[model samples]
Target: MTDSKDLDQVRSEIDTLDQQLQELINRRAGLAQEVADIKMAEAQQARADGAESAEVVFYRPEREAQVLARIMERNQGPLPAKNVAAIFREIMSACLALERPMQVAYLGPEGTFTQAAAIKHFGHAVLDVSQDTIAGVFNQVESGQCNYGVVPVENSTEGMVNHTLDNFMDSGLQICGEVELRIHHHLLAAAHTSAADIVKIYTHQQTLAQCRDWLEAHWPQVEKIAVSSNAMGARLAASEPGAAAIGGDMAATQYELQRLAENIEDNPDNTTRFLIIGSEEVLPSGNDKTSIIVASRNRPGALFALLEPFRQAGVSLTRLDTRPSRTEKWAYVFFIEFEGHLRDPNVAAIVAQLEEQSILLKPLGSYPKAVI
Candidate 1:
């Protein structure tokens, strides 16, 4: 205790330990990002198979609650809860920023999950505009109302968002960027109480659909009510003691409600992917993905001809979605998302061929692939 040099040595060792810890944490984060990138690629491939149809229009509030709770449970070390959330929040922000200062539109009434995802991708600093419906969001981007729009494309537990797909077919919008948000649902009751006394469950129609099987098994007799959106449902429940709503945790915290049940989905691997819409191209950063829409004549060989070029050009197609063309009764357009960028010579060549073969071909632009 009386030796100054000894104290100095101890401090120096502590400093070196701190340095090591920082390096170790950074390495771990880098690896996590890499894995996330791989998952995106796998999902794009999955979407191509029409298996994305499984979640075409589904939602599960309880399972989403579980994931966030687990994320909170696993958190440890010197980082505080807010700080850790902030880091991940920013990690997503940077991924969307590989192309910079993007303007994003979303379906919103404030506090909606789409709004949350929009911020997660573009950050609070981004220019955000919200419309009432998914189609409205696309229309805004299509009419140049916004630089890009953020919309839900698919959910792991539920299925594809047909409204979003339908809009993609009709509008000039194209998916320039993609982000996946692992949904965590919670039962937010207005007052602090147990689950037994709850009389009803409230949430968006989609949320109710996602958790349908789980809810039927547990609260079979409980009245399931649909609201405008999950966030709005939570807001209403936060003021009614016997009422409960399923929504993101932010809604619970905002309304000062109690979280009753967490992660209540039938599927544990539930996640939702979002698309970034823009009229022009995204400047690439080495890694990239491109999405396009091809409108074919409503004939027997139409779709086959549209896809043949990609197979011949050796272009790996990641997703192929067909939506009814609002233009006519039997008209339809094929939406395709694929690996590689427009800047790539091979990608450009394939586009040229597809254009010659199809009635209309729209390139949604290429954006940097998520570094994760």
Candidate 2:
């Protein structure tokens, strides 16, 4: 009887805390709406003054990054810092929706890792639209059909995603943010199917390669098939009786499949980096990365010439890759990423120096480094 009374008292305290939390969240939402209103009014006044680009932009990646960083910094939690920040993210996402609804596009048949990255970056309140291809994702954002798009840029095991890089060549979209998702491949099948019943396994070609050794060791006799995406493979697994698919958690849930095995990728540290493309440029978040494309004259030591400026300016280079140039058959363009915003003095000086040496230089916009 005493234990039951103690349980009831704890439950009562929890309910009281929940009520207080709900009130605070609503109060925070009211403040967000007020901020939106003020911005909208300011934008309207600017339009009256003949400003062409006085549109109210509600989503600020840098601001969100800073907020999340602060939240993590100040946490003294029984709950993990990341967990607390995530709860705040959904709160902010919901409050932002009260201000203005957001739409985001990602490459998908609906259950791809890119989609998961989108949710991670933007939160679940935003409407997520699925595009058939990476280019389609860019087009969606470029055309203003969606406010932003998420697309995979690189995989740890496979290197760069060339299709995503190619899309950046012609598109005017800016890189607003980035996300790094840990890739975990799961063996999934329909509820009625089991390991002994499986005849074929399906997954994306890249995924199949990631889990190659594990697959060879466990299911040696099973036929493996490559599909366009893991989500597609999940679809097949859901429909076919004797088929299983290697995919991530989202795919398993989306297709209502059971996980036969978890984290089957050969490389345990498998991670994929995704870029968020948008129409607006993101301001500096203290911690940021800038991406650019440069073309140099075909000559000896051209690579050194391009890289010398960054070294001279003391800017750290994070990534450097070469892509086939669309303008010249034999020439290639350099895709460079570094650790500073374009607005920084050293970064700006480096860009000026590169402009003097390179035939073509294009700034792809600086963005906040991934926080979560």
Candidate 3:
């Protein structure tokens, strides 16, 4: 049995540790502010030396990823590594805000998973701007309205998001980072509504498909309506007495709806991967992934030829998907993701070989893999 005196002593020690931690964190924030000041001074000096506008970039995705990785690697604690990394992530985010506040754009009418991904990657210190469409999110970052944007790339169950892929074909924005989020969908209803009152269900088309098996097993007779977004469905359910919405926790909390059924997705391991977009190119982190769009000439074994270079270079290909080419009929462009920084000699050599074989080879920026 533990004595009350020992417990009190432990609590007192914890309080002392907390005070020290707070002081160290503030000191870290001060150092970050100094880093910003140095960068600004350098930029000003460059402009004075006859360079066209030397804009200082406060955020470095690669640097932050490295820091998070180190934190996770060094952690030896009662708390989980991921939990510790998350605590450090918020600390870094707050310190970065002190250096220069960041605005991030995400697809939303509010309460979307994309919005959650943006917050997960950039931390809540960032000002989140909601856009109706994925393209709108990209445009926000491209037009300098937001420093960065978060958009869904693919789902484990639903495959690629074609709209996001198509936008990348023309956009000059670089991929700065990636985020993978485990999706747990819920069936939600207003406080006054009940399962017996749910005559109709509303959800985004993709989400509806994800929850199709569960819906068919339980609520087969209920009318399922697919809306533009899950957040939109939550809106309709809030207004209609006989309606319920299928969405994530964010949507339920945002709309003040109660969960009727939780973890209702057809697949238990359903996850979505989101890409962070920005104008600045990221330097190589130790662990990185490169994304590219390549249009191979229409010929025998063109697909094999396009991928052979990666195999030959001993580099692992992470993902490959095809999109219809806009310039030519029956021709498709390949979106290739692979494990390596483009700066690596072997990766650069592979790119050179691909350029020769491909009619169009666009090296979408290499970015650090998701940290948390």
> Across residues 321-354, which tens digit of lDDT does each residue of candidate 1 receive?
7877767787887778777878888888888988
Each candidate's TM vs. the true structure?
0.70, 0.97, 0.98
- How much lDDT does candidate 3 score? 0.94
Angstrom error of the Cα, residue 61, model 2: value is 0.6
Model 3: per-residue lDDT, tens digit, 270-319?
Answer: 99999999998899989999999999999999999998988898999999
Q: Which of 1 and 2 is ahead in TM-score?
A: 2
- Residue 301 lDDT, candidate 2, scale 0-100: 98
Off by over 4 Å in 3: 1-5
Question: Which candidate do you rate higher for TM-score, 1 or 3?
Answer: 3
The residue-level lDDT of candidate 1 at 86 comes to: 57
Model 2 lDDT tens row, 1-372: 544668778899999999999999999999999999999999999999999889899999999999999999999989999999889889989989988999999989888999999998889999999998999999999899999999999999989999999998898889999999999999999999989999999999989889999999999999999998999999999999899999999999999999999999999999999999998879999999999999999999999999998888888999999999988899999999999999999999999999998999999999999988
Q: After superposition, how far is residue 248 of candidate 3 from its true place, in Å?
A: 0.9
Candidate 3, residue 13: lDDT: 96
Give RMSD to native, each candidate.
12.6, 1.8, 1.2
